[model samples]
Target: MKEMEQPVLSVRNLHKQYGSGCAACRDARRERLLKNYCPACGTVYACQDISFEVFGGEILGVVGESGSGKSTLMKCLYFDQEVSAGEAYLYAYQEGRQNIFAQSAQQKRYIQNHLMGKVYQNPLDGLRMNFSSLGNIGEKLIAAGHRHVGRMEARGRELLAHVNIPEYRVKEAPKSFSGGMQQRVQIAKALSNHPPLLLLDEVTTGLDLSVQASVLDLIKMIQRDFKISMVIVSHDFGVIRMLADRTMVMLDGRVIEHGLTDQVLEDPQHSYTQQLVQSLL
Candidate 1:
């Protein structure tokens, strides 16, 4: 896909608070402690005033430590969690900026199925463990309005092969596969619909070093081949270094810094980002 000047995804002032508007939650937002959890009202500011843009065919990396709310940012963009406030627009869905946060359930469903694909850090969160690899992909296709069993299975098999799963194993349950393979299946399933956007949250987090490299390689290859835009969230700078064209450094759910990947990595300005870059050195 050719690069476009306009962003494929534009998110502004997004917030995801766990509890209803209590004084604690309001205070958390006011204090800018987006990662804070208050015992007073049991509110967790999982994400706050998060804003960014993902250009077409670009892999935008979001890096932050645990509890920094980077994952929550991706979750909000993927529509897995409801946003408490703010607006998000997917250019693929509409020309005018549509506040996706205000969209109806049906509209959200359409965006998820037709416009974006998501792969989670835990394969279990993304894949149907009990189903065969083919069945798993078929389910995603079915959600996208595919009903023909023959065509669905064929597309599923093709994707399994693309992901380097043995053709014979296509009939086997994903639960029986190794962790890395399960992740591969999840990737294949996510790509079945050829979505314009992909959301990957710590996809290589727990794998062995070599396995992580392999999975990361596959992701890079998929991006190159499909030319899909990706929002990848990881704490590992190595992953960000290998995959992202641009990078965003998140802290307390806020994007403290964002720029071209090399520029940000090489010349970090924020104190937190400077520390993060040095630690990886």
Candidate 2:
């Protein structure tokens, strides 16, 4: 967290919308839209001028209610969804000089395969249900240009083991595993490329309380052990509190507050953020 150290991932003026915006919704500075939706043109601004930086080995948590654009932000960052407007720079890609959003399809694919990894909220979205856990991890390894089967298999086994997936179940497909196990496998696959940045979208949302705890613990462990910068999106303050080094609170597709986790939790400046912190009490 040194002032002179460059951020691992830097994003600026990120915006995403589902429909073409009208004059009423075009000028977001005026705040004319109703909760990110324009009545006249039916445009839904999922994210508006969202900006943030994640430093190396730091976890930046994004907490917001459903439809708050947090998940959309993650999708845009991971290239699962295209951004309407924005620029994202990764230190590991072109020395952070290139705007990732503007990269060519092939260049973007290279970034996705080698510089970043993402774990979707739904296991099905992140994993091939029919593929064995090792196969899933191997898929990522292959994309990263690992050609030797022996080396890839070794790396896959090491990652699965790191995520606490049983060796016996390495050959088992995620379809046969529990929700928690599937998530673990997804995480293992995401980590296969050893990407400097990892994007996780509501990873513990559907899990049981005990299962959520285990996954949270696993995340913390990964952060500590791998020292990879992460952007974790969740609606739960509890999850953010447990994992984030810094927190950003989003509302109506805008960032209302952001600071160190403790600062935001202890002295929430915005009313919406206050309500969120209160709900956690």
Candidate 3:
């Protein structure tokens, strides 16, 4: 048998905590409050000893309830939150190296530009609400080296259309579109540069079933067409069953069970997994 290739992204013993007593720890507490926390303990550990690997051309789904660390892990992986310990390695082809922890601003820029794509729970947060859908998608392409501004606009329109948005809506501000339409725009933005790894954090939250399914179909099509590795964090088992090759069950910042999606779905071993499956049923 041919040996499997290395994963496009690898995380080991990753830890992220807010409000450590270390003098270097600044007041992330305010940010936490803005996110709907009241008198949030500074010592909250959102992710503890988390580890995972995402291979090229595969989808890994993370399933958990709210406050279960799914979004926290994504935040840490995307470098939006500070990691307290451990390392994450991102594959970089041009320099022929794996960037671990990516502390340097230059390193972060390299990954953000070339290797990573992200979609957030609130689609508007991922896009420039004031910009037209075309402009929102075009911004990333321009940043990725689309030198001709005219070509950028044309390309943006094409991508928006691909996501099933009307070409005529391309020039309208994202704020004017419905939530689902804004989500399509966000997906278009994330796909603009075609990064090897796509991180989706609760991509379908707050939408109606039909809207969620439509967005999901688009994601499925994109994954199949581009063969990009995806890490999707969702509370919905239906979403995981439809998208994942493997599934990881998280609860209280720890992985309870993980394996082939079918294997776990058919016969979950962990008590938490069994409970979650039963609840869904």
Highest-lDDT candidate = 2
lDDT against the true structure, each candidate: 0.87, 0.93, 0.81
Q: Write the per-residue lDDT of candidate 2 for residues 176-205, one digit (tens) a residue.
A: 999999999999998888899999999999
| Candidate 1 local lDDT, 113-176, one digit each (tens) | 8888999999888988999999999888998899999999899989999899999899999999
lDDT of 3 by residue, 1-281 (tens): 11277778878888776665333333433344423233434455566688888887899999998988899999888877777887887765443254456458676766776678899999756899998888887778776767888888877887888899997778999899988898888888888887888999999999999999999999999999889999999999889999999999997667888888999898999988998788768
Off by over 4 Å in 3: 1-3, 21-42, 93-96
Cα shift from native, residue 246, model 2 (Å): 0.4
Given candidate 1, what's the lDDT at residue 121? 93
Candidate topping TM-score: 2
Evaluation by TM-score, superior candidate among 2 and 3: 2
Candidate ordering by TM-score (highest first): 2, 1, 3
Report the Cα lDDT for residue 9, model 1.
Answer: 88
Count: clashes, candidate 2: 0
Which residue pairs clash in candidate 2?
A: none
How well does candidate 3 score on lDDT at residue 49? Answer: 81
